[model samples]
Target: MKKVGSFVGDWWRLVSPYFRSEEWPYAIPLLIGAIALTLGSVGLEVLFNDWSRRFYDALEKKDEAAFWREIMTFSWLAALFIAAAVTRYIVSPYLRLRWRRWLTGRYLAHWLDSRGYYRIELERTIDNADQRIAEDLRQLGEYTMQLLLGFISAVATLISFLFILWQLSGPLSLKFIGIDVEIPGYMAIAALLYAIVGTFLANVVGRRLISLNFMKQRYEANFRFGLVRVRENSEGIALYGGEQREMDMLNLRFADVFRNGWRVLFTEAQLTLYQAGYAQMAIIFPYLVTAPRFFAGAITLGVMMQTASAFGQVYTALSFFVNNYTAVAELRAVMDRLQGLQEASDKKPATAIAVEPQPGGRDIAVEAMTLALPHGQTLLADTTLVLSRGTSTLISGTSGSGKSTLFRALAGIWPFGSGRVHVPAGARVLFLPQKPYIPIGTLRDAVKYPDEHSAASDGEIVAALETARLGHLAGRLDEDTHWTNILSGGEQQRLAIARALVFKPDWLFLDEATASLDEVNEAAVYDALKRQLPGTTLVSIGHRPSLRQWHDRRLELQRTPGEAGRLVEGAAPA
Candidate 1:
C-alpha cells in the first residue's frame, strides 16, 4: 500500500502540471468528452444485459411475437451500443493525441530551458534523456490514457453490474447448526471476493516485473542509441575499418537486451498463466455456484442466464487490476523515469559559476576565476583578464589547458567554476566550437541558426556565405537536408563562420573553430572576419602560428608541474 501510494504521488507530480497549464482549455474538455462517452457506453452495456434476459425468456416461452419484439428491442440497443463504442473510440484517441501534444511540448520546453540539456550532459546522471523525452513521454501519455479510462469504465461497470447481479441472484440461505443464515446479494459478494484474491496473488507474482521492466526499457534504449551512434559515425567507422569492433560492441549491448527480454518473457508467461486461468474459471464458476438454484426450479432459465452474465460483468470490473498488471507495471516504470529526469533537470550544478553584467561596460572580463574538474582537480588557476572593444585577441594554449572550458565559462554555459565573469550589458556574443552544430533543416536555416531564418535578409545571408567563401551554397539555401552529414568538416566550419557573420554579434569567441580548415582557408577566413566584422571583438583559441598575426594581443596559458594553467597576456610570437 505504501509503495502504491508513492507511485501515485510520483505520477501525479509529473502529470498534474499539464492540466493546470494553458493546455487545460482543450485538455479538460477532451477529457470530459471521453469520460462522458465512456459512461454512455457503460449505460448501453446495462441496457444490453437487461435485454439479454428478456431475449432468453422470450425464446424459452416459445412466444414468437414476444421473441420478435425482444429482437427488435435488441436491434435498437445494439445500434446505440455500437454508436457509443464508435464515438468513444474516436473521442478517446483524440483526447490522447491532444494530451500527448501538450505533454511533449511542456517537456521539451523544460528540457531545453536555461541550458538544462547541456547541464544534463555534464552531470551524466541521467542516461538516455533523448529516450526519456521522446519514447518515455510517448509511453507515459499512451499508458496514462489507457489506464485512466479503463479504471473509470471499470468502476462504472462494477456499480451497474453489481446492482443487476444483486437483483438477479437474490439471497442464498445456508443452514447452520441451529439456525438459517441468509447472505444477501450473494453473487456480488462472491465476485468481489474472487477479484480480491486474484488481485493479491497477481501482485505477489508480478512484483518483480516492475524493476525488470525498468531495466528492459533502459536496455532497449541503450541498444537503440548504440545503433543510432553507429549510423551517425558510419563515416568514421568506415574510414578506420572498425566495422568488426563496432559490430562486437553492438552485439554486446544486444546481449543485455536479449537477457532482460527473456526475463520479461518468463515473468509475463507466469502472469499470463494466472490471469488466463482466473478468466477461464470465471466463465464456469458463476454457473457452478448457481446451478443448484437453477436445477431446483427456483429461477427461470432467463434468470439463470442473467445471473451468470451479471456475475461475469461484476467480476471483470473488479478484476481490472489483475488484468492490467502489465500495463500498470509499465506505467509505473515510465513515471519513475520521467520523474527522475524532472528532478535531475531541476538541480543546479553544485559547481555553478556566477556571471554578472557590468552596466555601460564594453568588454568581457573574467575576474579571479578558478575552474575545477568534476573531481575537484583544478583546471584553471585564479585568472583576471579583460578583452576590450575593437581589439581582436587570440588565446593560445596547449591541449587540455582549459581554453575551451574558459570559453564555456565566459559564455555562461560551463558551471564548474568560481569567481565572477563580467560581461557588458545587452551585448550579443557568439561561441563557435570546433565542430559546428548544423540543425537538421535547410542550409539557409542552418546558417541563420540559433536565430530564426527570418532574422536575416536573403541578401545578408548570401553576403555572409560569400564572405565565408561558401558562395557555392548560396543557391542551395532553400534546400532542406541534414547539413551535418552532407557538408564536409571544412565546409561545416565555413558555414559556422557564415552563421556568425549573419548574426554579426558584438563579440565572437572561436574555440579552435577554424582548425578543421587548411592554413590558407583558415587565414583567408580570419582576414574576411577582420574586413567584414572589424568592430566585433574577436577572441579565438588556436594553435596555428599563422593565426597569431591577425590579433593585436594574445593570452597564453602557461603551466608548471603541480599547478593549474595561468593566463599570461603578451604579444603573439610571429
Candidate 2:
C-alpha cells in the first residue's frame, strides 16, 4: 500500500503539467471526449452483459423466434459498443502526437536555454538524451492515452456491473467442512475480494520492475551510443587499430543490457504463469460458484447467465492494475528521467564569467583572472592581459597544458574562472573550435548560421564562400541536406572561414580551426581573412610552427605532467 501510494503521488507529479500547460484548452476538451466515450463504452458493456442473459436463455429454451430476436438485439448493441470504442481510440493518435510535440518542445527549449544543456553535460550524469526525447516521449504519450482511457472504462465497469452482480447474486450459500452459512449477494463480495488479493500480490511481485526497466533503457542507449560513436569515429579508431578494444568495450556495455533483459524475461514469465492462469480460472469460477443453485432452479437460466457475466465484469475491473503493471511502472521511470533532465538542464549559473563589453575602447582585457577546472583545481592564476582591437595574436602551448581550457575560459564557456573581459559594443566575438558545428540544413544556413535563414541573400553567401576559397560549395547553397558527412575536414574549415567573413565579426578566435587543412589551404584561408576582414581582431590557438607569422602577439600555457597549469610566453609575430 505504501509503495502504491508513492507511485500514485509520483505519477500525479508527472501528469499534472500537461493538463495545466498552454495547450490545455485543446487537451482538456479531447480528454473529456475520450473519457465520455470510455464511459459510454462501459455502459454498452453493461447492456451487453444483460443481453447475454436473454440470448442464452432463449437458446437453452430452444425458442427459435426469441433466439433470433435476441441475436438481432445483441448485434445492434455490439455495433453501438464498437462505435463507442472507436470514438475512444479515434483521436488517440492525434492526442499522442500533440502531447509529444508539446513535451519535446519543452525539453528542447529548456535544454538549449541559458547554457543549461552545456551545464548539464559538465555537472550531471543524465545520458541518453536522444533516447529520452525520442523513445521515452513516444512511449509516454501512447501509454498515457491508453492507460488513462482504460482506467476510466474500468472504473465505470466496476460501478455499473458490481451493482447488477449484487442484485442478481441474491444470496450465496457458503459451505466448508459440511457447515453452511447463507449470505445475501455474498458471491459478488467474494469475487471482489479475490480480485483485490490477486492485484495486490501482482503489484508486490512486479514493483521492482520500474527500476529494472529504467536501467534496461539506460543500458540499451549506452550500447547504441557506443555504436554511434564508433560510426562517427570509424576512421580514427581504424587508423589506431582499436577495433578489438572498441568491440570489447561495446560488449561490456551490452552485457548489462543482456543480463537485465534476462532478468526481466525470467520474472515476466513467472508473472504470466500466475496472471494468465488466474484470469483463465475466473471464466469458469463464476459458473461453478452458482452452478448448484442454478441446478436447483433457484433462478431461471437467464439469471444464471447474467450473474456469470456481471461477475466477470466486476473481476476484470478490479484486476485492471494487475493487468497494466508493466506499463504503469515504465511510465513512472520515464517521468523520473524527464524530471531529472529538467533539473539538470536548468542548473543555476556557476560564478558568472567576469567579462564585460568595453565602452569606448576597442580592446579585450583580462584582469587578475583565475581559471580553474570544474572541480576547483586552479589551471591558471593571476593572469592579466590585453589585446587591442585589430591586433592579431596566437596562443601557443604544449600538449594538455590547459591551452584549450584557457580558450574556453576566454570564451566565457569555462565558468571555473574569475576575470573581466570587455569587448566594445557591437563587437561580435566568434569562436571556432577544432570541431566546428555544422547544422543540418541548406548550405546557406550552415554558413550564415545562428543567423536567420533569410538574413543573407544568395549572392552575398556565394560571394562570401568565394572569398573563403570555397567556390565549389557556392552552388549548393539552396540544397537542404546533411553537409557534415559530405564535406572533408579541409573543406569544412574553409567553410568556417566563410562564416567568419559573412558574419564580419569584430573578433574571431580560431582554436586550431585550420589544423586539418594543407599548408596551401591554411595560408589561403588566412589570406582570405586578411583581404576580406582586415579590421577584425584575430586570436588563434594552434601548435603548428608554420602558423607563427599570422599573428602579432603570443601567449602560451605550460604544465609539467601531473602538475598545475601555468602561463608561459611565446614568440610574437611583427
Candidate 3:
C-alpha cells in the first residue's frame, strides 16, 4: 500500500502539471469528454449484454418478429458504440499530442536553462536525457491516457454488470456435513476469485518485466547514441581506419539489447500464455457454473444467456490488472527514468563557487576561488586573479593543470568549486573552445551563434568573417547546412573568431581557440582582435610561445606534487 501511494505520487507529479498548465482550459475539457466517452462505452456494453439475452431467447422460442426487433435494437447500440469509438480515436490522440507538446516544451526549457544539460553531462548523473524528453515523454502521454481511461471503463463495467450477474446467478444450494448451505451470487463470487488468482499469477510471472523494460530503453538509447557518435566523428574514424573497432563496439551495445530483448520476449510469452488460457476458459466457465439451473429448468434460456454475459463482463472488469500488467510495467519504467532526470536536474552541488555581477565595474575578479574536479580532487587552490578592462592576458599551464577548468569557473558553469567570481554587470563575455560549436543552420547563424537573435546585419557579418580571415565564406551567409561537417577544423576556428568579432564582447576567453590555424593565420586573427576590439579584455589559455606576444601579461599555473596548482604572474617564455 505504501509503495502504491508513492507510485501514484510520482505519476501525479508527471501528469498533473499538464492539466494545471496554461493549456488547462483545453486540456480539462478534453479530459472530461474522454472520461464521459469511456463511461458511455461501458453503458453501451451493458445494453448489448441485455440485448444478447433477449435475442438468444427469441431464437430459442422461434419468435421471428421478436428476433428482428432485438436485431434493430442491437443495430442502434452498435451504432452508438461505433460513434463513441470514432470520437475517442480523434479526441484521444489529439489530447495526447497537445499534452506531449506542452511536456516537451517544459522539459526542453528546463534542460537548456541554467546549463542543466552541461551539468548533467559533467556529473554523469543521468543517461540519455534526449530519450527521456523525446521518447519517454511520448510513451508517458500515450500510456497515461490509455491506462487511465481503461481503468475507469473497467470500474464502470464492473459496477453496471455485477448486480445483473448476482440476480441472474440466483443461489446455489448444497448439502455439506448434513447441513443445508445456500451461496448467493455464486457466479460473481467465482469471477472475483478467478480474477484474483489470475492477477496474482500474472504479477508473479511478469514482475521482472519492469526492470527489463528499463534496461531495454537504456540499451537502445546507448546503441543509438553510439551510431550518432560514429556519424559525428566519421572523419576521425576514417582517418584512423577504426571502422572495424567502431563496429565491434556497436555490436557489444547491441548484444545487451538482444539479450535483454530475448528476456522480455520470453517473459511476455509466459504472461500471454496464462492470459490466453484464462480468457478461453472464461468463455465456457460461465456456462459450466450455471449449467445445473438451466438443465433442471429452473431458469429460462434468456436468463441463462444473460447470466453468462453478465459473468463475462464482471470477470473481465476484475481481470483488468492481469490484462494490462505489461503496459503497467512499461509505464513504471518510463516514470522512473523521467523522475530520475527531474531529480538530477533540480539538484545542486553542496559547495559551489558563487558568481555575482558587479554593476558599473570595469574588471572581472576571482577571489580566493578553489576549483576541483568532479571526483573531489582540488585542481586550483585559493586562486585569485583579476582582468582589467582593455588589457590582454595569456594563461598558460602544463597539460591537466586546470587551465580549462579555471576558464569554466570564470564562465560560471563549473559546479565543483567554492569561492566567488565577480563580473561586471551587463558585460558581454564569450568563451571559445578549441573546437567551436557550429549549429546546423545558416552560415550567418553559425557566426552569430550564442546570440542567434543578435541584430548584426549581413554586411557586419561579412565584415567580421573577412576580418577573421574567413572571407571565402562571407558570400555563403544564407546557406543552410551542417556547418560543423562542412567546415574544416581551421575554418571552424576562424568562424568562431568571426563570431567573437561580431559580438565584440567586453571580455573574450579563448582556450586554445586558435590552435587549429597556422602561425600566420593565428597571428592575423589575434591582430584583428587587437585592432577591432581594443576595449575588450582578452584572456587566453594556450601553450604556444608565439601566443605570448599577443598579450600584455602572462600567467602560468604552477603546481607541486600532491598540491593544487596556483596562478603565478610571470614573464612570457622567450
For this target, which candidate reaches the highest TM-score against the unseen true structure? 3
Ranking by TM-score: 3, 1, 2
* Tens-digit per-residue lDDT, 165-254, candidate 2: 889888755575555877888767978898999998998788888888898889999999999999988888998999999999999999
Model 2 ranges with Cα > 4 A deviation: 174-181, 354-361, 418-420, 561-571
Models 1 onward score TM values of 0.96, 0.93, 0.98
lDDT of 1 by residue, 1-574 (tens): 8988998888898778878888888888888988898888888888878878888888888989999998899888888888878888888788778777877887777788878778888878788888988888888878988888889999999999999998888787887455588899998999999999999999998888899999998999999999999999989999999999999999999999999999999999999999999999999998997899889988877888888998998999999999999999999889888887887777787666678889999888888888876667787867788888888898887877777888888888887878788889998889999989999988888988898844688889999999889999889988998878998999999999999888888999999999999999998899988888877888899878888888888988876645688888867556
Question: How high a TM-score does candidate 1 get?
Answer: 0.96
Q: Per lDDT, what order, best first?
A: 3, 1, 2
After superposition, the stretches of candidate 3 with alpha carbons farther than 4 Å from their true spots are: 176-179, 572-574
Indicate whether candidate 1 or candidate 3 has the larger lDDT.
Answer: 3
Query: By summed lDDT, which 10 consecutive residues of candidate 3 come out lowest?
Result: 170-179
Tens digits of per-residue lDDT for model 3, 1-574: 7967987898999999999999999999999999999999999988998898899999989999999999899989989999999999998889999999999999888888878888899999999999999999999998899899989998999999998898899887777456599999988888999999999999899989999999999999999999999999999999999999999999999999999999999999999999999999999999997788899998878889999999999989999989999999999999999998888777788988898999989899989899989888898888788888877899998888888888889989999989999999999999999988899989989988989779999999999999988888878988999989998999999999999999989899999999999999999999999999987899999989899999988999877646788888988545
RMSD of 3: 1.4
Top candidate on lDDT is 3
